[model samples]
Target: MYNKSHAQMPMDRSPPFSSSSSDSSQFSSTSSSPAKSMRVVLSIECLKGSSKADEWTGDMLQTGDIVEELRIGNMIVKSPFKNGKSGIQKILHGSFKQKETSIRVRVRRGCADLAELQACIVPGDQFVGRKQYVLRAIDDPNYAVGFIDRTESQCLDLQASRTSRMVSALERTPLQDGYVSYPWERRLVEMLSIPNSSSFYSVLFLPKSSDKASARYNDLEDTLARAHTWINASQASGVPIVFMNIQTESLLTKISGDTASSTVNAGSLSDLSNIANTSLYGFEDYHGVDLGVVRAVRLWFSPLAGEIPIEIRIKDTDTRLGFAISRTPEGFIYISSVIEGADDVPSARSGLSSLYKQASQSARLLVVSRISNQKLLPWMVSATGAIRCFDTVSLSQKLSLHRHTRVPILVHVYLWDRSANNANVGSIRARAMSTSPPTPPSTEAHLKMTARGVEEGEEDSDEEETVASDGQEDITIERDTAGEFSFRLHDFALKNNWV
Candidate 1:
């Protein structure tokens, strides 16, 4: 009869078995008696110094450890195979060729306790499971018996694989489980994965779609087309575009503990009353819980319009800047008025008059997108859907300091495009108004501004005054003795109501 007690004996007493040099000899010795169990187990000869060994095995495997079973994913190859060591080698080679990420080996170490070994054994099955046994090499001093921990690299690989599978499933069926989805193309994904590529992109989520004829649906199509065009054009100019989507609920959960479920109950009645109101609080709610969507697409691309970057140097003799600044309701800071015929001022020297003239002739606004290399454009959107921008008061102070210090300022302006016919500006303003909440009177008073420096009581009565065209408003700042304007641009804007 097979001696079960002998098989369970401590491995330290037995002579070292070298499977690499004499697999056949070891198998023959074990198979000598027909009544005895012939288990052809493999042992670790030595581990290679490769990174794969450290990442996949580390100290879990050691020299002279008995490998009872090998597992690759769901497939398990146990000891006592048909061809002994050669069979296990063939299986391992096949797994390597298949590029399997997970490879687990159930090993029995010399110091493993007899009680622990017996406890690890399966009740019904003869073969031991991969996670059942713990190696003494791993839990030496502590002697705690549990499943081996996965390496960091291995954990990351598993997570990446899971995410990939989930994304693939999402791409297959976008609309699933009351969630709208948009999958990024593989090319866009690759582009975005490149280092520092995130800053080049921006995302905007649209409301949920129920009707194809609805304006929301049309807007979505238009936005997609525009983004596509921008990306294509940017790519042509050697700039790669990044387009991506993320789950709104997941984002909200991470940022704030609020889930889509709570908002869903709040908006349920309203959603039932008006099918058009797909969101819990309409489109103005940027939190995105009301959209009932898993993913929304956002695109980032290089500048599409011909943005002219102008460098204006403040000379010692210059007093008046020769231009007025104002912002549109859509958060565009623009040259509202220019002191005509001023030759020595910084604005005229920088050729702002010519650009202003072109803009006037084309019925377009001379918009300043950036000042002193810092972007002055609307940089963020509030939860209430208001366009959040750089405070003009602070910007005026910065400009005033620059003038006092005679520091040069760089500005980026969007030149008037005859082909576009101011359509871009008009569309942006219309879109902002459609989704944005009405600006409170107090807030409007604080933000709106038109600023120009003029001599005391130098009113031009003959200059047919129009608000959009160099018209004198309620607030006027007199030029100081040094010729620098001393009033805050936002203060002027508040009094004039020039938003």
Candidate 2:
């Protein structure tokens, strides 16, 4: 129906149109053109205690405008203020307020040049790279429709592809019955097989238990190795790794010198110094790892374990029983048993402090199990802090995201509490880990230092030589930090450099 010239003419401008008509034409041109279709990402960070939700609006926003959403990314409010759910809905409603200034917004366009896009741009770069701009009504009457532009950064999730490598390589079968259903794990596996181009965040869970048999010691070596491999790969590729420690249970079962089912309540581990430090009956072979670190481990009670004298689990406001959540330096959050009934507020507060210490500090992986009650909802939010949640397929999907988009993939351990029968508690929870990523080059330097020490062990102590990958030993040797054992390996490698 249109003329041939109409199709060939420039699309952004109006031809012989009035001012109002021209404005409509401009809006239509911008909305329909492929040049306005840019990919964007959004992230949220440190969102806690039911604060205000970040909103995005304006019909003029292109595809690539929203890049990242983080807890403490560029876009953040200086103070902690309460926000309602309507904020996000407001964005959907295209309610970019040009009047009451309260929120901040940032927007930016993607690089047009192919080289710049490929050499430095990333999947979430169009959004994450720039500093967040405030959404003030004063800055242009179109404040609500304004876009903030910022710089791009290297995301860990867009660079990994071996999310399933650990799962596929493992020879052990999953615990059929005793194990809690960690949907996070399942989600990670699924995501690894099917990749995405975005930031990946997830958690691994360690169920609460005083029983070492349920500790999965057999899988310990494999699990630890898997974490190492994933962390190593992530570090090599600029991804961050958060590892959570195991949680301990406070509910004890008094044994009648019988089967595993027979038990009693011994009490909470919070009073370990007062508990007589008595050797636990079934825990004779148990090492001090579980009960040692209060920050990394949490405790809870189990109905299946029978009843005992002392009860350590906390009772929530709803009387559904609660437990404390804590963290370790390796990014693991330890969970405790729940306290049901009432009147034990003292123990609950103490346990809560410990849980908060971990949550507020380092934990990245969180566990969700059988405990039920809405009173502990605030606690759950506190534990998550600045972390993200994902299904079992998250890990894999994260790997794929990293591979395709150059984002970092965060690793989390997740567990579900069977004690929680309520449906509203959600499927997964997470905490950040106490992890210190080591530089590969530093590791190599240490290895070389160790090798030199090993070589020195065999040489004439008075006249030793430190040489590179050469046969001639012409360099003088110096020992600063490492001992003789370190040099022994170097001498051995030097002797067999060809191999």
Candidate 3:
């Protein structure tokens, strides 16, 4: 039944080249002129048969025939392929998955002869699978037509390129720009430049081998020591340091059967390091394609130069935290205002008073990095350069509860150094100033409170009196105004909280 289907396989009737037999004679006659190069084509070298070579009978395919094109099912691939033998093997592998019965091949009898022959290849005892056909490129001695070998029942032996091996290693690693450094050597992969700054982020790869019990312990110690060095260097230079460790495995196989696909395995240190200078730096497989097995351990180091860590312990009698918190458009939380002359408040006693005075005089901001041991700074950046941070509303509510319960709050504030050339400071100041909201006009009640002290119990009575005065002013303004009546009405409503 299979033989009948194979025999009925469709073939292309049109020839790839001219059918005129006098073409070779015309080429020999033109030899007196400039010699032209012949187009390269594939040829059948040797076939593996049962006993000796060329044992198969009734087969239309013969040795030394130039392959014109190959067709599997509805898909057809012409000659002079870019990837050569590898490209053909890939097509065969895909066809195997589709369970294709046969493939049609068009070939030329000889270079001097223009006769085209078509043949159908099917699975049998001699050629058990599609991968059994091994093709290789060969140089033509005549320099007229180069030949690429097409054989059956042979294995393909080819080495993967260095870039391919590096790409494979990077895919196996769990983190971007990470590779396993085997044999206990610390190697720098690449240095990524930071925008608007002279400093750079260094990428390094460390290896973790579990072959021996002592090797694991040694790797751990080395990682810790390297982390300490990075942290210290970053602190001393007032910069940030980040590193990730990639753990790689050995001996990974992706072949489902005797034929292997184009999947590359990890290689030696030289092979993996060769990609550092290429354009593949910082390459990541965002699609989650399977390459190999690997593990990642990440470490982050933040600058500690101008950071001030303060712990504020609230007392039972303290009515407020004595500090107002506001967020910039850039999603940074900062101390917008501080209550003055309140020596008994928690903020006054926690040394925030000095910091606030210094910040006010210097016209700088007190950017809060952490509150109550919770980090409030931006932890991630999106592709559009937008920062991700904790919500300010929830943080303010938590701080209000802490003040009501007299709980201590630990805060980490970043102070910008005026003498230093800090790009972050300049960026923050520019963005804050550009996106700052216009200040609202002060109310008459607030002015009165500032002039004469009003107790907490008298606040409601003062508000009632202010509302009555505002109503009388609104009525008087309406009677006296004519052309500017609409503006007066809007101003009255804003002042009396009618809006």
Candidate 4:
């Protein structure tokens, strides 16, 4: 994945370079040439529609570079490839093929036509899904833009043209409070969304929430063009736009959840972060593809719900407690993991492990509800009908309390078993829950395997033999990949046949 943060080009006049590649040199000699000629013909994950890498012809000539000609359909576009960019290319150049001429690319600012387009989409302008823009004509408002999607052709080419006229465009779209796609912009998303019959197309970045969806469609000059008057991205609002050229294979894997097809070696959701890079991934189908089947992204990566507050008396700080804490986006704070060696700590010896049985083995993350007298955010029910939220800034002061200085602190952890049972009995309404008092924390040192609180139709896994145990044969458990769990567990059980 050729990763580079993209920035939208500023509004300006005159296209970055002349339309003709003929003016470019077959050899590099910019010092004597006047035209700064180049064209980036690579697929941008966010800009191109096809979930595959694409290439096109470029006029940027350089010395000692191998430029292969790609014959796609009737188009003989030069494949814009560079040797130094790929390790395999280096190997080939040094040993096998012996082609010293390696390609070098200078990625210009994103959006080559920022100056002429003048970044202006007035009210009532619509985008059709296929890169077509239907807006007021620059020359005459009555005569709408017949066609604006053609790149190899003129800016105003039509199936029927009254006259050959050049329409001057705005320099910039002017970044405003309203959402706007940078680098590829909204236009490029549509362009990519348009079907590619000749070759595959790739985008620069992962599309924002509604990147594939267009509000409107137009069929001017008999060409399909997607048009959206409004900007896309409800989840990306206020988030800075970062232009990145991720691998096309990566986007497909995350979008389709197909690990076998992924080229970036993305085994987990964290690995695909460079693509969507947002926290709004619902543990469901990405786009329309169910993640359960493809098994591309790890679902249980971030499980924090709210601020979790834990209080413990100062024990010896040198013992190196195995317990670790993590956060979730939902606002639930919980004990993420408890190291096995934590039993050596003074507090664990006294009874902390008793309070955290399965938690020690990473069986489950224990949710913390309160610390001593103070209740953690949202978890506490108050008569004022208010849910206290955690302020990391102020709360960190208490969490950072010196172990050697502080006395024993009462830690109130939410027992998952009790929570499940309570929910099973009947879920408490927010109104009633707001007035409830904290439940007495359970302090059992060795909870049973049944204490895991498995839901109906799901049995306890601990009853089955561990993979390391004797008389255990590993079996595959078919499961939904998009579910809370990303991978299927290898069930090790006693081999028995009773039909």
Winning candidate number (TM-score): 1
Which tens-of-lDDT digit does each residue in 336-371 have in candidate 4?
A: 334455466533654545555644333334655455
Ranking by lDDT: 1, 3, 4, 2
Show the lowest summed lDDT stretch of 10 residues, model 3: 152-161
For model 3, name the residue pairs that clash: none
TM-score of 1: 0.36
Per-residue alpha-carbon lDDT of candidate 2 for residues 23-42, written as tens digits (9 for 90 to 100) = 12222333343433331224
Which candidate number would show the highest lDDT if scored against the true structure? 1
Candidate 1's residue-wise lDDT over 333-433, tens digit each?
A: 67766666668878889998788777655545677766755666544332223444554444655676677688888877765445533234456432322
TM-score, per-candidate, Cα-based: 0.36, 0.16, 0.29, 0.21
Please give the range of 10 consecutive residues that has the lowest summed lDDT in model 2. Answer: 113-122
Q: lDDT value for candidate 1?
A: 0.42
Residue 45 local lDDT, model 3: 40
Q: Tell me each candidate's RMSD, in Å, in order.
A: 18.1, 33.0, 27.5, 27.4
The sequence of per-residue lDDT tens digits that candidate 3 reaches over residues 196-226 is 2222222222323333431121233444344
Give me candidate 2's TM-score against the actual structure. Answer: 0.16
Ranking by TM-score: 1, 3, 4, 2
